[model samples]
Target chain A: MKSNEVRVARFDGYERVMHWMAALSFLYAALTGLAIWSPVLYWMAALSGGGFVIRGTHPWSGVLFTAVIGWMFARWAKTMGLDADDRVWLTRMDKYATHQHDALPESGKFNAGQKMLFWSQVVTALLLMVSGVVLWFPEWMPRSLRLVAIAMHPLAAIGSIAGIIVHIYMGTMSVPRSMRAMLLGWVTPNWARLHHPKWYREWRGSTNLR
Target chain B: MLVAKLIDTTLCIGCKACEVACQEWNDQEYTLGTFNGSYQTMPDLAPNFWNLIKFNEVQRNGAEAWLMSKYQCMHCADAGCLAACPAPGAITQLANGTVDFVHENCIGCGYCITGCPFDVPKLSPASKKVYKCSLCSDRTAVGLEPACIKTCPTNCLTFGERDEMIRVAEIRTRELKADGFKDAGIYNPAGVGGTNVIYVLNDAKQPEQYGLPKDPIIPWTVQLWKGPLKALGAMVFMGSILGAFFHYVVFGPQQEEAADEVE
Candidate 1:
């Protein structure tokens, strides 16, 4: 029989819903964005109804995605703040990559990797929104301004997508227990102890375990 | 045989008939609204707007000049968008050398956003799809000129075989030089593995003068990183699935290894 261990809620119902909403919107925006960027991926139109439909949807959805990310940032900004331990953890990422569990640093609510992801998403979300608006209303601005936005938009998108690819991999596959936190809103005490010892201790002190 | 477009910027009158014709013939929507002094409402290509007429005012030798160019996909032979796309059916090159889009197979990953040098592709927010100029493949299949070329009142845009387009561009360049335009030249013949779209500049301005890259090539780091990273991600996903299956099948969903270690 499984032990009856109490696990504190890291994400409330609203937070969890927002988290998945942002994720789904981001995924959709990323795909449509790629389709418009290359003829090689033009077939993506079939997924969204047709090419014309894809054209109509890409930019508006981008707005929604950006809006949701903004809300998420505001809600989680305080918790995602980095500390000295996080810096040290980031510096030793290779150990984590190689699956050296013992060599990994102890963390609080979020590990160094999670903090890095949080910050990266924040930066990317801002860049995409700003650059997107510039492109949307190019005639209102000077030609030079539009050119700069065009150049920056692609560069920012590339960097963000690369960051997101790693993020999804880590969230879903590399760390088995991480997904459960986002999904069911609970984790085993052993998992909390191993991954986030500080949070585990704090939670244990505040609430009794069965 | 790659089909291409030869655009004579010198002859372009900035009437924007080509822009209108393209939208009407392709059945694309008029997404651009009046903003600047000109009727060319389109600022850039979008999912709905594939072709755009860019108007630039330049001062050359103390003389005022209006530089007009039609912007669209270059349809590069080694298209960065092609290499970067995760979906197999999103983009394809036709047998006649035209880059084609198939919306059915796209997952909208936005990889092509960084892959394109010209920044041609655009996403639609309403339907979550990509859109760009398809060179009027449907029209071209029946040997009809593209809507933009057919509608150019100044006879500025011409479509033909790639080799023939280059020849026309060269002849036009010579004519411009003879007419005392020393900087007249043909653009993008050999760059980016040669582009399907050719341009004829009236003045001595290089391609960069018209907002094009002098030497457009895919970034080496993007190429190097994407292939291995994708492979590693796939491997990890597959490995996890397999590991889960093996554990459930062999150990009947409850492994004794943890218990043995505790003992």
Candidate 2:
């Protein structure tokens, strides 16, 4: 093998762009939303321009975030689906968390924990969008529906936010060097094989890059 | 004295002089509309019409009754609009208990409309801001009564300090009760810490009939859930960091894959 050939195509450029768009917008929406949600954090409102800007931008960015999530769901839903092995991986989430890879189930492109995060976020994002529209122009909505929407918006937001925290941490921190795939749309061949051996084997047998 | 208004629904002649006075004083025109076979004009509050008279007819024991109410903001001690507003200074609860708006500070996010139990504020697409009766803050600030109060021929709408207004409303309520109106009562909802603008309703037992909420509390979830959710966000953020640290300390990061076939 050539020493220069150190990379594997883990994500295409378009996929990486969609991923960054989702990540960046989700962060903005979460931050601006937090600023609007709590008076103590109102000072953070300046990050989105101002208090009014937070109110206005938060919902719109939420819409953008949902769209990106929708695109992500379309792209990855098949790969992220749960099977018997996924259930096993979830049952042994403790092993994965502690990097007991030998004890961990043979993961595909995404592990069970990642699948769980994806599905939870998808549900939460859809709920947020539906509830956000109710809150967006509540002047026209009946009082009862608006009240429910107002209450549920936060609940869904809380779930998605916490899930996202774990997701970002897992993607970038828990498994070190994992962000190379997301950042530059490639991972070291070694990184791919270690994290996703099944994918590596499939790719190795199908194509010879060099 | 801090300003307040008394809206005696029993005394309201449904003259709509106050409505006209409101439009005149504010220098505004109302939305175009055709009569919907009801005396109730424009259906509900709008940007143009800050004040409105709601009409209701009921058949009570072989007699037809036409009930009228001067519907507007209650200007509560704990205003829902102020609580739900995300934009700073967009909605203000004055020292006098008059809830007003600083339009320049308002961003057209309709949370206030949902927050308001009375359904007072309306979004004006033209101005792209919520507008409602500011309790004539401009006139009251100058020591003049609101245009609505000034033009009320029956002397129904009165303005004064908050305590005095409540006192007057209580007395009126007693007189109506003695007059054999069994349900006559004051409509200063206690749930919102009582409103500056009290109402002497001939039949307060059914505020819903007059399009007023029987219990006008500020939307509780908006206020209640915020603190817990904020705490949750902080905890989750910390948990992510801690979880990662613990995983790394234990596993020391996955080694570069030694499988050289792919590499």
Candidate 3:
């Protein structure tokens, strides 16, 4: 809370906007899709504006999510790649999960776990999109293709949903100030130094800060 | 007492009366006649047109012979449409053994179309709802035979108890066999748990010639997808969410160190 405290820029405005767009569309698609997947969750259709509205809107929301994720992939794929340090950090993920952050290697802007979450989402988003298209236009597809899609869509959805659950938990609960970084596009220098020391050092080096 | 309809293909004169009667009784929109180089009304059933009399020209004793059968929803006891439908109550197997589609709940996803082994259900382009034969559930509920069975001039279509219909079909099949139809048999396909709408085909061995699958079954892939795979997906979903909740409880958020604060 000091007035002289330094603020490190984490995410830009454009990145934060794209991230939220993806999050919202993903939530919409997931809820509606679950409504259609099981009788137990059939009541969810009412939450998503009923079965009729969801049938018309769910696929389109999936398209929007895929498009946004694709954009994020293009913008972040290079920096999100796994390096030697990230591989070592992956081995010590238990320490990272248990709040023993100092036991793990210094992380970059994104840690190994975060990068894994990003890549898994992108892969599953593409899977959902392809299978979703097959389901959206059943008449155009053959029986064999339809069979594969009917199974693939939900399986891929499970993958992405699992990743997002962890992503939300980590951003909001496990790590402090991480939500603020995506929300306001900056984090306190102490937060950066504790969580992503390598990135913090790079920012200091670039800015000539002691 | 499960009700059923038995169609005797041998007795059918290809009069097309039952087809017209079904259209009239159901109050379905009239489909325009299209010639496809044969007396067969339409190549296949339409969303609006629920019933059709398929005309097949096959070689019998080196001579061309016509094979006809009334084609509509088989109303399978284990209907794939009911099994594949994600929208609860959209497709249901009625107490009287009729599989009906509730138009109101239909999301028009066409999963039923994919699920159906007989390819009976059709999605309407205009309303985006699926349509098929309800076996005159409205009429049968009132203790009356289906419109198709009532209107059949040749008495080819008969409606009664499931066991009685099967017994009648067996007798007719035996008679056809005696008349030199060696392949004549009942077409109630046990693979689908026997259809409420059974058939007595003259050439049961060659049912594909009558536009019916030789051995109709709900694809195993569809069964797995709607069954165990769905359960697996639900488990994974619950596991992830619960895991996150418990992890948060056990290990609190990684708090920022006080010493890291700059003076």
Candidate 4:
């Protein structure tokens, strides 16, 4: 955070804004959904509006999140794809978890774990949207389909919520400069070189061209 | 005393007086009945129209027989609507076996509709709240019979203690069997742990002919979703948080090593 530190561009301003939109909407929808999922968590409804209001607005929030996710997929799908290096990184995940980062493959813009998070989020979001629509308009669907949706919606929600919890924990606690990159769209060259050597090298090459 | 209503289908004349009384007492809007080629009025129960008389014409021994029966919430002892409802106290089973809907607490999610084995709960399009028969808890709490029972002129609908009502229904079933209804029996389906509304059917072998399910049970999907599925989801949610916390405590934050930084 020194003023004289050499900084490298990570996320752009538009990407940061889009990420916040996705995060906020996802949190709202997940909270409201949890409120309506069980009476034990019914108290969560009081935190937002009431039970009826949460029930009504939860699906709309889900729609907003799905829209943001679509934007993210279009923007980052190319970089987020898994490759040979990512597979190598995945195999060395135990080392990564144990802070043996030197043993893992060089990371690019996103690490293997981040790519996995992105893909899992995409899958769970798709499940939520389809099942959410079915639940919202139950009268339009057959009982069998509705039954499947009622079950699928919660399962997908559980998956996404748990994944996001880990994402949040990693972003804010486990890694230091990750949140700053998402917030200010910049990270120090040393930080990037330490965490994502391939990305730092690519940025250095692009800057040298200019 | 667990109060109940015993409906003797043999004594019913398909007059629908109980339905009329129910509408009048509940102050529901007057709905025009279409000619569905039957004496029965509406196709099914509506949010406002809680009680109904279903008329089913069946061929028995090559003779046309009309099976007329009053239909409403069964008020099961193990009420599925109450079980599946996420909104606390929105749907509750009273001490007298009446399943009541507190519309104020209703989130209008329609989970009750899916949970109900009888498909009794209907979501009101206007209010967005689910509604069903209250078994006239208001009147019964004040020592008065339900409007439907009081208005039934043929003594077909009778209200009393649950045990006494079952006894009365058993007697009626015996009398019906003696009078050539060989399959006459009482219907208080045990699948839902019996119901406050018991019926003495002339042809109990085919309750479906009376517009009643032979083996009505809470949908297994709802049971699984609200029961073990909910428990599993909670466990996973907590497990993830605790796992993250324990990881943070054990390995600490993965900070950058000073030697790795090339300033």
Give the top-scoring candidate (TM-score). 3
Angstrom error of the Cα, residue A158, model 3: value is 1.2
| Model 1 chain B worst lDDT run, 10 consecutive residues | B254-263
Tens-digit lDDT track of model 3 for A1-210: 441277778999999999999999999999999899888888999987789789999999999999999999999999999999999999998888788877888889999999999999999999999989999987668878888888888888888888898899888988876888999998877777777889978886787555
Number of the top candidate by DockQ? Answer: 3
Ranking by TM-score: 3, 4, 2, 1
lDDT of 1 by residue, A108-144 (tens): 8988778778788888888888877765553344444
Query: Where does candidate 3 stray beyond 4 Å?
Result: A1-4, B59-65, B257-263
DockQ list for all candidates: 0.08, 0.54, 0.62, 0.51
Q: List where candidate 2 sits over 4 angstroms from the true fold.
A: A2-6, A53-56, A208-210, B1-3, B225-227, B241-252, B259-263
Residues A1-210, candidate 2: write the lDDT tens digits.
642266778889889999899889999988887777766777888876887566667888999999999999999999998888879888888787666788976777777887898899899999999998888877667778888887788788888887887777677666777887788877766676788877777777777665
Task: Score candidate 3 by DockQ.
Answer: 0.62
TM-score of chain A of 2: 0.94
Q: Is candidate 1 or candidate 2 better by TM-score?
A: 2
Candidate 1's residue-wise lDDT over B188-215, tens digit each? 7454687888889876456665667777
What digit string (tens of lDDT, one per residue) describes model 3 on residues B6-121?
99988999999988899999998898879989898898888988889999888877998788988999999888888889988788788889998899989899999888888888
What's the distance in Å from true for residue A74, model 4?
Answer: 2.2
Superposed Cα deviation of residue A72, candidate 1 (Å): 14
Better of 1 and 3 by TM-score: 3
TM-scores for all candidates: the values are: 0.58, 0.91, 0.96, 0.95
What's model 4's lDDT at A207? 71
